[model samples]
Target: MSLTRRGFLVGLPLLLAACSTRTTTTSTVSMISAYGPIADDRFPLPGLNARLIQPHLRRQEVDYESSHAKGSLVVDTPNKYLYYILGNNRAIRYGVGVGREGLALRGNAYVGRKAEWPSWTPTPNMLRRDPEANGPYRNGVPGGPNNPLGARALYLYRNGNDTMFRIHGTNQPQSIGLAMSSGCIRMLNHDIIDLYERVSSGARVLVIQA
Candidate 1:
């Protein structure tokens, strides 16, 4: 499929209840489809021109050790790196697209929830800033390969309230290593999926000012 600047976003089941011989039960369940490998064609294949990821300067030292701090997510906005703190000092670091100059932030938060193939609802702020992006998409865009959230989302909350930002996947892989998103941290689909699998709800996330 052709890559659209707005695409790259891509998501359930139910259960019933019954009783024994003469009984009746009712239940509700949802199933998650096992996601397949992200097709190379679905993304801009790895190439020299593609945005570089986990570049040397941003990587923790090769011999980095995993500390108790492992399993953390670090957003080094200045360097455009998001590190998935692996146990010991090592981490799987990925390049990210952060907010622009005036939009950058410094703070700490945690992942309050995680979603695969997440739907997106442009915030009121977003709609006010981009009227053309308004209209039917205001409430929320359904999750799909064409969603701007790419393939996943890890919602960030501070003091248990949504910061309205996320550590999420991006279809704009080219935007990685740059500042382009609307204050959310954007990662490659493969990278976010990998990190998503490793992190859990309530994982500590630190966004250090670069």
Candidate 2:
């Protein structure tokens, strides 16, 4: 099931109210502290080299004034920013690599599922566009450090149908803030792992395209 723009707008208020009432016992400060510099052998994510990325593209907490309810995920395409609303006019912002011009998606969706080290299968359309690049992955690529989908994935859905779009980690950390994907939004592997742990399945996401 997919929702039209009108349908999503109609339900927006109700969704916001429901999300506002939910709260975690943990403090936002502590939560930020917990997500400290990512270092774990289990996933083997290499530390991000600051010199490789611009200062603005790095993950950081910022003062975000928005009408969206707490816990909602907002993607500002033009700014290359993804914000997780933390209430109190604050948000945890992560830099993202968005879809190249013609492939971008906008409007509302919810995270229908989540995965760790998710598999990647190139769609038929993707394979057709770049056979040499995507054809071999038609059967799917096993998840790992080198896989394009990286360490975590949050699958987006609208009206219960898979959008075939995702907020997932990428093997190429330097791609953050660039418009260079088929459609999926890409995050740093470390950042995605942190976001995956914080966001719940079914959380609302709003994408603003400019």
Candidate 3:
């Protein structure tokens, strides 16, 4: 639960413990306090301008209507929202930026692996689509503030094979709530860090196609 790297959650779905959630109705946690500058991180991060983000796009606990088990994740692609189902009809909602029109992942998958400040390398497809943009990073980028993967990454898998899809933090915080990624979902640095702690490696995920 500490933001440490976790091995690929091999074998059964429940290989890791269920994630604990915060759902107290009287909780006093505020937006500024949660999204403030993170100076103590390995690579210090600047505070986000919450005012620039739409209220609905900000991270918050909400009354979720879902039949999925607690700890399951649901990505509402069209709405640009990711729901961390905590059951009891509640969930923590975070804004997400998804892949463009035909590039989003769909159906079921699970967190096969989780990493803090994970390394990032462009795929062949990415290179082909925009060599001028991705060619430079073909050698890959080390994990850091400037890294495209940002502070954390959750690798998605299906049938025990890495699907090459991810739910990760991004250096472009402004991209949240937009459709501009390759195929993986993108979250804010602080939000993904918060999620990385709460979600276990084997947590199930469902990405609803747009």
The prediction achieving the highest lDDT against the true structure is 3
Query: Which of candidates 2 and 3 reaches a greater lDDT?
Result: 3
Q: Cα lDDT of model 1 overall?
A: 0.63
What candidate 1 gets wrong by more than 4 Å, as runs, is 1-68, 134-136
**What is the per-residue lDDT of model 2 for residues 56-133, given as tens digits with 9 covering 90 to 100?**
555555656678888889988877878888788767677799999988779999999999999899877799889998
> Which pairs clash in the backbone of model 2?
none
lDDT of 2: 0.74
User: Which window of ten consecutive residues has the lowest lDDT sum in model 3?
Assistant: 7-16
lDDT of 3 by residue, 117-170 (tens): 999999899999999999999999999988999899999999999998899999
Clashes of 1: 10
The lDDT of each candidate is 0.63, 0.74, 0.80
Stretches of candidate 2 off by over 4 Å are: 1-41
Clashing pairs in 1: 9-144, 10-144, 10-145, 17-25, 65-88, 65-89, 66-87, 66-88, 66-89, 67-88
**Lowest-lDDT window of 10 residues in candidate 1?**
11-20
